[model samples]
Target: MENKNRLLLYVHFNRNNQLSEHVLYQLQQLRHNFEEIYLISNSKLTDGDFVRLTDSKLADGFLQRENVGYDFAAWAEAMKHYGFDKLANYDSVTIMNDTCFGPVYDFSKTIEQMESDNQIDFWGITNNRSHKVKPWEDKEAIVLTDHIQSYFVSYKQKVVQSTTFQKFWSGIEILDDVVAVIIKYETAMTKYFEDAGFKSAVLFDTRKEDWTGMVVHDFSVFNLPELLRRKIPLLKIKAFSYGAEYLTTPLVVEQLKASTLYPIRLLIDHMTDVDYPDRAYMLGEKTLTFNHENTSNNLLKIAIHLHANHLEPIPEYFEYFNKYVQDYELYITTDSQEKKAAIEQTYPVSQLKSVILTESDEILSWWDVATKMEQYDLVGHFCTQRNEDKNWLFEEVQQREIKQVLLKPAQEIFQTFKEDSKLGLLVTDVPTFYQQFKTENLTADEIWGNMAQIWQKIEFRKDRDLKRLSNKSLKYATMVWYRPQALYNLLKIDIKKLAIDSGVLIDEFFPAFERLLIYVSWTSGYDFRVSPSLPKERLVLEQSDNQVPQVLGVDFEQIRLRKLLKELLRKVKKIITYRFKLKK
Candidate 1:
């Protein structure tokens, strides 16, 4: 038997143009399998990243190209640079991408097994069966043929030296559309080589149906545990990043942690960098409860800032805090001296640290208290407002916000904060009404635009993903328990100037600020979790129900009347448009 020499070309991409730990870990594991390894990146590497790549010494060579064409383009560019004549010196060549989080087990065993089977000219880790209809194409029902998945594919010298392979690499063009690239390169490559009289095989074939009777062709996405059980080396990163319908990411994460020596933090870092919005929801501790007994105080400094515009809720709010919070300093702001006096008369004045009279709205009051935030480790903001509208939905949401934030025992919440150093903001879940109407009412372009304007004012951390920040779930009512340091950048901003010059509506500013709070915390290297009155699971189920909650006490007649008015307005607009057209 001849001594076999193998070459590996690893394709990588990072939006920040920095090399990630996972990619490095992958190369470190695979370095031994190949005689020489080359790293081909779509992103132009930063100076620091280039230095680190050179220092690692895992790759024999490196190539950086424009990020126009996905993994296939990177591979093609590598081939073009190396040339077919030079590549023919190796017995086998493996082309892999950074789209997965493995070799969960050892890479050597899988490589040995594949190398022993010399019958196949080329091979891949997985293969897809022919589809009745193409997945990406909706307008036309086109059939998709069976092909080897392009993520981790190896070619024997015969396939590599063949004119067909050389021609395929030569014909590679810059494709802007990802779907087109997938169709032309990834899906077509296997068939193209097969038509040239080359045999192909997959380590874990998806062409045959299994006992699970799972229809999903991508075993990497759905049958990950089974794949791992069968000692399939790689785990697809998309299983956790994009998420599968029936999959629970946390379970998979736990399995990976318990079973494999693979560094889990690498996966976390990659997900965070990509700005996957559900990263926290799927990976971090799900819900922090307020019902648990406080075991230790740890003496964390706490401050509560109350904007008591209306004095009606002052006494009740104080009672809730007194019962729940172990200790805290209080700051009160009122719109008038008369209202301040009334609050002082009704509530215990001795407990109040300071009572300031402010002529401006709550936004200005928030700005005035910003300087005092540094003194406290944990700070909470609450505002008292009397709803002028007799709208039941608005009242219901307001009550829910108050209950979730204030009614929960503060000692337990503080203890939770102490336990998780990274826990930045403890907020109530999105109101059921808002969640139901999120697409229609809550996620307006105006809201996102307002958030963007506010975000521009702050000196946010550079590494934070702006796209993820835009899609963050917010505490709409602006009631939250948060670490003061997490909100430092936001609190430093002069709210009065923002209110006047930003051209954002006073109402809009509050909601936008609330949304940006989560992002600010994230940028400050912190994570947030929901502390709902109900268990998060139960809350989700309740929210999913189509029936309106009885607690909302909504009047069906009012809804019907509103619907009628909308319909009437539409008819009037149509009539006006017809008359205006005739006049024109």
Candidate 2:
């Protein structure tokens, strides 16, 4: 059999305008089947990335254009650049995009299988069935037609040579709306070619399969595990981000690791560009103990910043640190000379770097010391003020939470950072005190309150999705173990000036700033993990009803019944009012 001359046009886009390792890996895998590969990037490449892409020699041709009209526009631009006559010379041309992760298995096998079929004019890795209403359409009454998913579609020589294909490419308008582009191109392209007498086939015929009760109509993302099991070449990138609600991304990640020789780091690097809520779940490693027997050899340049506003907890704090931490440069920030003297007395002045007196609150003090922190590789921040308002049990939980990161698992935490360069922040999991009142959405007002104006001062990454910031599992008391690089954006801000401009109280500023730290770390291209204070079973035991105390002369059981009766009466009143309004 004569080998066909295959060409691949791969569309690439990155918010940072840099080529990712995953794309390069995909191109490397695709080289087996395609004689020539062209990379079309919508995002203008950075000089470094441009050099990297060109130096790799993965693509025969490269096109960088204005990022408009999404992937379809990029494909159209590539087709126009090549000209129809030149494109027709190839036996087959495959148009694919960087929206997917793989070519997990060998691409040549899939290409061979598709090429063997003589009847099909064009083919795609997967296809969608005609549905009542399009996923994005609610009021438009649009019925999505059965079509080959545009992410990965290959056209035979006959289709490429045909006027219909040429006309379709020429007629594409650069639309601003994503849905408009999808309706005009992606969902319509297959039907347009078919109507012009091009017979289309798909590797996975989703029309015959039952997708009943599925979260989405796009099977590429929702049914990725099954597709991988059946030897599908690509995995949609959305599976890790928005698609997580419908499917378990960690399971799919594990499957890829076990089944294929694909580099998992490529996936992790790519995830930094998107809003992945499961960063902790996916990248976080629980540190039980330092793997090394001699932990002294691997000791990092550690800085422990203790905001000792209250002098009483100074002894307890130092005692905890003395017990677990082997070595660290201690920097204490105290408000009053009296408190500084007390802290100095509690911990030896020889061991301490300095006891700086600052009028600014905890967050401001941390920011003031940000310059000093940059010198250290790992920085741990804690405040004695966190224990002030809490009751005995709550205080104990808070202390344990802080100890989890800085004391009990201190060595393992250090080891985890040393081993994983990408691991930025290790925060204590939602403290038991806050767990009882956990809400999925913590409003900006609720979190920042009067200090909300501080957001304007902080320079956040433009590429980051600000919406995801609101939904993050926040570190309430802002106790954290982090790499200095993780808080680069936050640390760069002139926080003193910000406090002056915003007129937010120094005491209230820290809590508000704490809310934004997780987001800042994420935008800085770092991953964070939640370190649980205690084991799950132990936490359950601590949170049990037996731990609660009954107030003297107060009948809690009677009060509970009264609350239930009030709720029932309110519901009955609402029902009566609703029925009366309906009758009226």
Candidate 3:
């Protein structure tokens, strides 16, 4: 089935902990099954002692991360080196972790089955079942959705050689740009395969396992390891050895063995999400969805936008949108009035409510709206996530840690400001990131979206008996700046004038930067991290337990980046005044 016999069994073994020993036993036992076992290690793969590891009857060569550390994540930098290790010589690349395994039988047969099916994107496995299946729960098995952290994966040589790989977790700088980068590349790859009319997730693997995961949570009748032991005796039954054998009692084993392809069927099910999905769906691109699920959950529906065209794309896109959304109540919190009004006119606004001030609210945050708003869901423009190597922001500011550092101040500033302060407006020297949230419109059930999901459940739980979402971690971000540079220094930097300036344009970079984080719109309080759309009045109210105006914070680092951004407004003023005076 595969064009080549050299199956590159890729695993990045870290001598770091419990996982390493398990991986070693796995490699030593399975190396004979593969032609030449190759490994990429975070450990010292080349050290003389480690070199001895290569002498093993199983491992032929070893690749190490440190050899290729190009100042990015250990993973991203390692790819180029490992590409040298075996990917070049190999045509069919099967990528999987030790945790990700299937039938022990001929790996060649498995490749044959995959290719005979004509799925070059057959990156994951699926369970072939005889019984009826649950439709919605597919992703619980194996999701290729939000982000693919390597657990188990397989790819063709083309996927590995052709695409530029990136990896990132939930946080990174300039997320939109990072996300745009990831989407742009992945979409391109997926489209290339797609235009040929084969389904692929760009560089992402769209193939789903039958049950999505091997460890099915009682919900899926996905039988246990006991059921598997007979079918796959070399099964190294992890579930049972770890005291989980009860999941596969005799009856389930009998049912599983009944299949013609005993071990393979089970493995396939474990890889694909043939069932259990929509666990938390990605937001759709469709701007408006007519709600079929209805309650008097009225507040405002904000358009959590991910992009801005320097030139207007729609003269009156909203006019078309307003006609559909007007019946249900909602508030609009975007940056453009022409856009907002055109949208408002499109939908019936008799029930529509307030619009957030385009000036004060920079359009760079979904965290704010989810925290501030009373109710919301990302209806469209759903995104896909892969590991950090494919993530975009890693392309620019390029450090994973720097993206993490920015949030500390954001959380602090939010905690300090209370809505009652009525501080008509609080200013931060930090240009784009404001820690304050205006709380005038919060409802009785609204709680800070910044709190953990458990807290949101406890705080907002209608059931008085269980204080679930409320008791979770609720932190207040306070104004940590002003003291360092003082508020006056901020005005002198010209932020106050910028805020006052009627035609002040929202910067274009905010949305472009957030995609590096696995960003989705805020629904549960626990979901707040790097925000996609800035805190719009409605989304904040939806996220808030009580609506109030509060401080927006950013590390003075942003202020520093801004000083380098452009000439100071005051400096520009002086330059213009001098030029005019000289002209006289």
Candidate 4:
């Protein structure tokens, strides 16, 4: 079965750039296995754009035009002529594609392998296509005269007399011809070849299973030595065996994972002298190199590793108050098994088919699809610590507020807290209106840093205030501090002397007002005007954090003073109730 002949390799590439070049090199490495090669490129070429054929029998074929309609017709004619020439030159023939190509086999030794009856006509790398249709009903690779576009190999006579070949050369629907020929000719080629008393089949989708059956494991990406590692991946174990040290650190771990799954992988600038650079490059002793055979499929495992750590259920946060934490599921949109594995191990997965996403356009800005499925106990939002979490909550709420509109609500709260007396305590992470109060012309990054600094200072003051209260065993006005340090500082004083650290404002004023109503009741008081938690008339209150400013009686920290003041309101309510009773 040792058949020595050329593999008339043809590739019709689009604007693949570096990826194409690297694959070409991979093909060069594969040249050693092929007796000769004939490459026919049918596309527009740019300056310095090139494809190299190393098997000495390189015949670079070109089309006549750049226009798709015109170029396609010319390419079809060229393919017919080239197919004939390839048949006349080499006993065996093959064709490839721009996205990927290779696994140049020992055709001279195992040419008989193509003669197997079990082999298919068109081999393609495909997954399940649609959400509902049976996978077989959806498009998959066919190995015959039809669907032979991406990769195909056949005998010379079959190519010369092909009806599909004649129709392709006729120049009608040339673009569609590329697609249709693969579908139509797959069966035709299989039947014709068998009738002529030769057997051949397709290796569908270049999957490992297909290659295993053929027993062609140690093949190249054709010729590119370096790109061999990319276009045709070395076995996963082989990658782990490369003589290198993995420089794993905390920071690089997350970035490495996210860089692969999300588009951010493109942002990482590959360093020449670094150990374990991204999949894109390898910087060795003296050479800094990049492999153009970069594919997203190249980093599947890395992505899975990264997502596993941060994934918690959408309802994980509700755990503190409502016990019961169970695994949940997510119905994702993509059909990629690699991505599905990454998401599933890291996060709970829901088993729902993907719903069609209606992208926003000028006519419609919102879309919603709802169904009552009892499979899940409850429906809620999923959140990420990143801004995405907040956005998810707001997206469901459907509340869009401009900066001006948001300011109105903030101002109202600030003013009411300033004037009102019945409220108590305020404890929050940071002021909601901190952004509005900052100096203008600051960048977003600087604004965040500044806010952190301000909060730090508040925490320090709160600490000092608490220690003061604890010394005398006297309680302070309501406490409010947002940072971790602020919480620690508040603990300096006893809870009895410290403010509740609850989120409320103007609370101190309430207690003062209540005290006044009681005093007035005891005396026959008439004209009463009181100062706001004024010093001298002030009560000493310990703040939750040392950095928070100490205030006179009317400051934030007065927890239930408003209830005593409300004694006056209680009398009014009693009067109303008595009047109603009398009327009744």
Candidate 5:
């Protein structure tokens, strides 16, 4: 049996006193390796809270107090409680904190590798050596003070028993200033150990000559083979946050895909969902997987309608579909014969079929081009979706959303439609976040009204098949895929009537088409489906013949207005509370 005396001191600091999923996973990894684990959290957690951790064998016990000294202070408090001298009786002392993610691959692998290197008196999973100007000092300091990153560090029995180690903890003075505490405490630990004849080492040393003088290297491109050879298991969560700013989110994801971790896609999801707020759209990264079980028999045909300007993005999508998807047909539709000829030459001649349209108008081009190419099982429609008024950052985000969310899910989306015959129209239901929805400058109810009017006008034979024609509220999205027959009523609608009205503040015609398309599907004996379900209840028509369309025509406007009023009231409450706090 392993020595019970071997202690693992884990420092945790959560401002809310609530444990997050990532933090809990980190604790579970530590418990698997170390039997005697004591937690020191910088929160005034009650006995009931400790009961959960203790019951799960996540902690032997924990110390709760006001968060004053951060992780450094927590470690010192744990040492005092355990008894400074009594800690020397342990085989080793592993000091860790909830500062990162992982033991991503396996905790046992990291432990086995670290145990092999018995000569080292102390070691860390990673080391900090980035060059930065010291706040306390005037000169730029190479932040490497021969220190191991304190996030996860282990010390041998000899070092733990040493006078230098005991005195260092005993003499630590917790300071109010965070920078001072970090400099005097965190960075000082490794140096103090080395100075007292304890050999210090790291699993993944950043100061190694292989580094190309970058302030921060992208962790997504972290060499897993090299990490396995060197025995580095954990990834710093802050590395992705740094990558999101410095290296870009896409590159971070690209590098993560190459790692040895199981379910790399889920890891990327956690990065976008849990870690980086700016990269929430990257949750669609997993949609890139091709899960069409029987692609051999059914061929997925994709067509791209290109506008006059910036048809450059068309080739990339064509190439992506050709490269990744099997048994897929590619078609490009353009008004200009010259542009069509040029695009045909760029891709493999046999694979691509170009449909040159007589009409120059964007919607007319889609109608004529799709009809000319015979009928496809699935038809994908996309507008340029560019806002010349917005900055490049916004443009990049739009392109990513289009490419990652819309284009990547093609095969799976096609399969979803093929499996269900009743499912005619498929559109991605992007949640109306205030940050995004407010930018469009169009209310949901206003869009709803425009669609309702267009649907009523377009369906001339509504009385003939009144039972089939039921209204389902649709979200405004540019990218869509649907069965060709779904647009039977839509194909009959006169293009002249869709003329932009100058009286309206917004061009309601084109925007209304997005919603009207869903109505057309319903009238043509087909049901529309949204990828993610709606956030709130709206008009949704099920595939069942007996089921009635939801009562959204009149009630939707009132529902939207009430929601707006609630939001305004919340803003007003926040403003009043801020002013009240200012008076104090």
Candidate 6:
């Protein structure tokens, strides 16, 4: 069953300036399947990677040069040297590049299936035809004849030895642009082979899938079981080019689990090393790394700031705070001594780290709490802006963490801050769904007019700019996990100046601070991200490491679904209550 004459030419581009672990992993998966392997790079491979590749017993040779004609050029260069005159000796030749990630599941069975069928003169991992679709048309009008995507394709001995194969590759002009190369060589590859009467097959042809056409462009994680069952190998990494962000993190995880795939998530983690690092980070991967122990020691201090008058304390907040005491110092700061005494009576004194009294009833009492928080690495201000409803405190406090907050281990939370020096603030995803704040309508000029004086005080790192704040804005009742230094500029403003009865200026001031909070993070050479939902990769990693509590039956999907249903029911109840009041 072993194909003695199979040769693989792996064309790689070192886009990250280093040979990536994902690429190496892909190569390792491929190298053993072929008798002879030529590892070619469009850019200089790192010494370590080059040595590792060359050391492989399967590697016949390597070609490294400046990036010119993309994968097409790399393929042609190798073909001229090894494939042109020696095609008769080879049974099959695979032209592949590190444009995808996988063989997460083995492809030997799939390869065997294709080899057994002599009808397949040429074959590939997957095929797409959206290129033929007209701009106005939503679906492709013609059958996608380009039976194989250029990412990975194998030619049978008859096709490889034919004049058409040699002539087509020999005529390949060394184009400097990748787009031109794709048009001239990659797209034209199928036409040349087919015209010469060669039949082709793809392991996972998009035309065969029942899923919508848009799904074809993605790894189609939802269709993973079928793809794996078919033994399809390799997932197109570039397929996520424009829309990685649009794909929700949970769905991505589900797809990964369904596919039984691993490397793509790793790619997502180090995506910044690639082109879309920010998108990868947002899509719930740990795109940052740091000294974990050091970071944990300096974890953000948490303070529950309250100006209690007569509201019953949220005991759940204390339970949540106590759970992460090893990672964070919790402070219960209130203006009312009576409120502090009541809270202490409800919770054991041992659990309540420190209850500081500001001794003031004014709104500016938070400034005293803020001052107390300044000495720490970061501070989380958990204060209740609404007091009438107990459910409001529970809902708001529960949102203190992002969606699926249970997924984050306290140590990992501290590690996230340490890993990204630029991440100065982490705000829980804004509860902006409420009608009061239409974030889409707010603009920069509206948010910050006279606030420039307050902003100018904080010394920002010279390299960073805050121009983006003028466009992007956020909304939430102010509960934030913030770096005190990141907000040093806004906090330095006189507390007396900030207090007002209620007007456009008063409205502008606090909301402007919310907007300013985002800008100062960026301007001060620090960054802010809407604290993400549970990171899928983190959960998977924990599972793999056996850190998960198996006894709990903690199904993430079930938990997410339950939460969603609860939200829906809550909305329905609110609607019904409003209607009942209107009728009355």
Which candidate number maximizes TM-score? Answer: 2
**Candidate 6 clashes between residue pairs 3 or more apart in a chain or in different chains:** 272-277, 422-527
* Shift in Å, residue 6, candidate 2: 1.9
What lDDT score goes with residue 325 in model 4? 15
TM-score head-to-head 3 vs 6, winner: 6
lDDT per residue for candidate 5 within 1-584, as digits (tens), equals 23234578987766546665566666776676775888887866666667778787788877776778777787888888888678888878888887666666666755656655777888887766544546766656646375677888888788888888889888878788887787888777888888888888776676654645345442223433344455356766555555443323444344445554534444553453333322322323422234424343445564444443346666566655554344445555566778666666665556555545455546565666656434667766654444557465566465555555455655677676767686677766543331133245555466555665556656643332211222223344446777777776676665555444424533456666665665566556565555532322332322112122222223546767897999999999999999999999
lDDT of 3: 0.32
lDDT per residue (tens digit) for residues 149-237 in model 1: 99999999888888888898889988988988887788888999999999999988878757374547678776766787777888887
Give one digit per residue, the lDDT tens place, for model 2 in 1-584: 24579989999988777778898888877776788899898988777776776787787888988889888888989999999999999999999999888888877767787788899889998888887664464555688799999999999999999999899999988999888888879999999999999899987888878777667767887777678878888888886676553325555776788899888778866775565533532433232323323245446898899887777677777776776666788999988888778777767755589888985467767876778889999998988764445365676666766675456667777887898887788777556665554423434455555334555655665645555324334455377889998897777877667667667545555655766676677777777766664452222111111122222234558877997999999999999999999999
TM-score, prediction 3: 0.29
What is the Cα-based lDDT of residue 306 in candidate 2?
A: 88
TM-score for all predictions? 0.62, 0.75, 0.29, 0.29, 0.49, 0.57
How much lDDT does each candidate structure score? 0.73, 0.73, 0.32, 0.30, 0.59, 0.59
**Model 6, range 176-226, lDDT digits (tens) per residue?**
766556656666778778888999888777754566534544343334445
Q: Residue 454 lDDT in model 5? A: 58
TM-score of 6: 0.57
List candidate 3 stretches off by more than 4 Å.
1-9, 12-25, 28-36, 43-52, 65-76, 82-89, 100-106, 115-121, 126-150, 161-584
Our model 4 lands, by Cα RMSD against the true structure, at: 30.2
lDDT: worst 10-residue window of model 5: 543-552
Return the lDDT, model 3, position 185: 31
CA shift of 427, model 2, Å: 1.8
Clashing pairs in 5: none
